[model samples]
Target: MRAAGIPQGTLAAGQERSAGIEAPRGMEEDSGRVKISDIRVKHIDRELDPPFDAAWDPVPRTSFEATLVFVETDTGLTGVGSGDTMAGFAAHAHHFIGEDPLRMVRHVETIESINFHAGRFWPLEVALWDIVGQACGQSVATLFGGTAERLPVYASCGDLKSPDARAESAIALRAEGFRAMKIRIDPRRADEGVAAVRAVRDAVGSDLDIMVDLNQAWRPAGDITRSIDVPAARLIAERLLELDVLWLEEPLKGDDRQGLVDLRRSTGMRVAGGEMAQTFADSLALLQADAYDVYQSDVVLAAGMHRSRQLAELARMRNRSFTPHTWSNGIGLLANLHVAAGVGAGPYLEYPYDPPGWTPERRDFMLAEPLRIDGDGCLPVPQAPGLGIVLDPELR
Candidate 1:
């Protein structure tokens, strides 16, 4: 039942347990320990604003931003991580400020205890992993025992008004060297989604790989009224398959494990989800149910580097693709980059590449040097120790 390198056991050894249990082998020693030195959280706000426009979901939006969390070890090495929701970051500061950064597994559990009380402690966990990797003089990927440095990247476009517009954007992204692209589909109408796929496929031709994300996995209901379940998801999937989509992401509610399994079997398109899955148990359950072909673990949501890596390992063992979701911001993208790099080759890295909305400058405003896509569509595995990134002093 233990997924992601976490040891599952009862809180107590039980009354019948004998003294000769022998302290669980490695538990007897606290060797090679490193303590947490400092914790810094930055709330970043971007200058450039972008709109979120799609035929189905037309909501006004501006700025691509996120919260950057840094966990430093006593040895002066630091690790960087990011998250989307920064609502309760202050409350969890005490839980991470003085613990052993190297004991990522222990650190994640301690934070989980605090999470039960206040909720959402994954981002802080990510920062600790960065700290641990730096303390050990390795990239987060190498820390997880992954062999490869570079992984194939796919452009994750945000939103566009028309199918033609989306196609144009895809063409531009392809020119920049992306071999694969994932376009956002109109969740309201199946035909609009179909048109978007057709236009992009025609624009990129049959040679380029494409994926479509429904973003319909979870819809926030503004009122007390029940959330509307869109029946058009199935139809959209059918059309996408005809257009030769590599995969369909978040086609239905994420909690619908049976539905996802059935959808994958029914359509034969790789069903992908798990970006918002908040814990190891949630991911384990999904994997056990055979809910998805690709497991999209987000560093911001998986609660940190240790848990994320653990999820990646689980996915690898199951022969499932582990691609960390990178939509929060630049730091979130970089954090996942380390995790993806560590996962080795095969899975395509998610690169949030919708220009005017998620451009490199606005997305990575805090970093001294933004992580850029190479001419061949691959992002270089950061060579510097730890996360291989530093905050821009100007942003400080």
Candidate 2:
């Protein structure tokens, strides 16, 4: 990956696909001198036509809401990003108002400290990376360590559908060229969820890899509910293994380190999790405890790209899979895609798709155009500078 201030096409050997790229105009003039001119956060709520049944949310789902973060540089380059609510960030915007956009580490550190009193500030960091990529005339993936411009994607269904419904969706996704599909398993009735997985497997007949998400790692604030215990998780894991599940996701609470470790060891199923891990330290603790076989952290959640890159590298070194959870909005998905591309495709990237309600068009409503999936179930990483997306005027 090209470090800060490094010219394009100068990456060293074995550095994924970096080559034959010209630097942006006036790059030297702008360089590290460009400061953050402004920061804006927008909370958007768009109603979905068909209600999306999110497995974890206790309430009925109708519309989707997201907060977008934009960081504009003094040189006129703007980067776009999205994440959790930024309700507490308006007063703290001055912390980054006049800072250098290219000082990635400094910006990351500042946000890390500011997070104690602030909300999700990683979006700003993502926006800074976006600005740097735009200023350098390169895709953020190239700025990171990615060599490939496209990666295979799996259709990650968000709704808690019935066995028959899930089976039909699986067949449709397979016909659409998706190599894999993820099913959301409701812990309340995990038995039915397992049946749904079985039905999808039988219908697709091994043409696609199946992943099941328990979503047991987290819930809404002020809700201290328990989903499953170790014995119950073991039973579910056994059933999923028998049905040829590729990986079992978030099978227990985020803090159930020993439980996760034991489940992975005993069942031999790839216990995939870490999306709820908010910081590098949290992930480090999980890693130290051998908490998971696959790390599914979201780039927008806590790590962002700065710390996420490190987590991806660590996963690679430890011979573990690093597929990010991309269930958020378009910008958030794109941010995770850049990081996942940088790390190289392990199995498949998460493509949030449950049509009628959670279609790509609705999920990516803020973008100039919806990020469409190809016949081969792959998404071409945007080549345009920054996060490779121009926000819709309506959203702006």
TM-score of each: 0.87, 0.90
Q: lDDT tens digits, residues 1-396, model 2?
A: 466666687666777544455534443355558888999998888886567767677776778888888888788888888876777888888878887788787778878887776676777888888998988888999988866788999889887888999999999899999999999987779789999999999898989999999888988887789769878899999999998899999999998999999999988989999986877899888888889988888888767787888887888788888888888888888998888887784688999998755888888888888887788888889988877877887877
Clashes of 1: 5
TM-score (C-alpha) between model 1 and the true structure: 0.87
lDDT of 2 at 274: 93
What pairs collide in candidate 2?
A: 17-147
Q: How does residue 367 of candidate 2 score in lDDT?
A: 84
Q: How much is the lDDT of residue 307 in candidate 2?
A: 85
Local accuracy by lDDT, each model? 0.73, 0.84
Candidate number achieving the greatest lDDT relative to the actual structure: 2
In terms of lDDT, model 2 sits at 0.84
